[model samples]
Target: MAKMQRNTVLVVLSFFAIYFIWGSTYLWNKIAVTELPAFMLAGIRFVIAGSLIFIISKILGFSLKITKQQFKNTILAGFLFLTFGNGVVVWALKFVDSGFAALEVSAQPLVVLLMMRVFQGKKIQPMSIVGVILGITGIFLLVGQKEIIAQDGAILGMVLIFVCMLSWSYGSLFVGNADLPKNFFVNTGYQMLTSGISLLIISTLFGEQWISPIDWSIPVITSMLLLIIFGSIVTFTAFNYLLRIVSPEKVATSSYVNPIIAMILGWYFLNEDITAQSAIASVVLLTGVYFINTKKSLTIFSRFSGKRIPKDPVG
Candidate 1:
């Protein structure tokens, strides 16, 4: 009974961490990059966070050694998720609002479904097809707002965020299947370290300006620290734990709520504007997400290739 209670409490706490902490990361990233170069900022953040976690994990008696295949998978996953997925989105946020970027990334489940179907030959559920269509339509409506359409470079930025979403979905799928270190913290630390180094190399190759003696203003420093400690360590650890205990589809439900948290934070803290189209689109997109993640609701069409594909309610 005590174990059950403890499990329930941990689950609830992990949900809170992933929902609120990951949601707030968008705003923090926006603030941090306002004064820092994107790649350098991200590189430093991850490296420091990874190093700290590595040391803490070691102190906690977690083994740092892993198989060669594990190392390779971790490096590939890191580059895909952190370097291209997160680093590019941080860069793109210079031209895009934090809330909008969150909305764009909220389509990750749809992208993941496509990746599984195309690469792994997984069968697509009938409702998943409808969800994808609705998701695309929601994106069109969301991006049609005057605020986004009028901004310079908004189109390119939005495209980059979408690319980021694709990379993240692929990475998430890969990591979900790959065998890694038994220790989750150890695996995450290596991922961060590898991606951080890769990002720094890319920054150097691209001739990104390096600011010496970074201006440690309260906001910038606070944002960086928050990202390192809460965003990287606590929230990510919680997310990984959730993935262990729940189905990936259920774990992804956090994406539906993240945009709402991000939009609210962006509005309250950064004074970012939200239009009617975006508001409507949020509802539509989350509805689509619900459809994609939920299983076996209402069957409409199922007799293709002698298989019965379940159609679920839009709820």
Candidate 2:
């Protein structure tokens, strides 16, 4: 009984960290950008974080041996995670605010659902289709206004951001499908190292200036450190820990929790200027997400609530 209770407590704590701390990362991203160029900052942050994890793994007696195929997949995963997923978010900040970027990026699960059908021939529920329609419609409204349309040239940035999200979705799918290393810690460390280095090399090619030394301030450095330490390491560690101890359904639910925190923090800290449209879109997005992810369960819930539920794994 005591062991069971302890396990439950750890699971709750893990969920809390994912829900709140991860949500706040968008605000952190906004602040960090004040001092660092997106890609350069990403490169430095992930590289250091990855190196620390790798070194720690070595000290902990983790095996570094990996099959050639595993190494190749890791690099591909790295590209998706750091390059497309994170890289797009970094670059988009120049054209769109971090809060919006966060909202936009939060739509990853939706993109994944659609992509699964197209790429893997997986079945998608009808509710999922409607939920996606509502979700995508909301996004289109957010980005298609006169003022917003003026930012259309930033459509390139938008496209990059979506591509990044798709990359993350695909990488996540691959991680679950691949021949993961004997030690997950070893695999994670290698992935992070690859991702970090990939960012550094790519950023350099794009001429992301590495030395913005003049712009560094206490807040900037602090935010960068937080991302490197807490966002990448602590939260990630907690997430993996949860996966080890719980059902994926229980662990996977964090996808729903992160965005609410992101939305609240974005408004509170970044002053991302949420309007009526944004608010409506957010509500609709949330509704769609709730229905989409819980469609099967909510079909049951609707019986209890005497109301219809919308659709799975929404943004």
Instruction: Give candidate 1's TM-score.
Output: 0.89
Report residue 77 deviation for candidate 2 (angstroms): 0.6
Candidate 2 lDDT over residue span 131-190, tens digit each: 687778767766665554467456765677777777776765566556656565676677
Stretches off by above 4 angstroms in model 1 are 1-5, 246-250, 296-315
User: Each prediction's Cα lDDT score?
Assistant: 0.78, 0.66
lDDT of 2 at 226: 85
Error of 2 at 222 (Å): 0.6
* Native RMSD of candidate 1 (Å): 6.0
Cα displacement (Å) at residue 233, model 2: 1.0
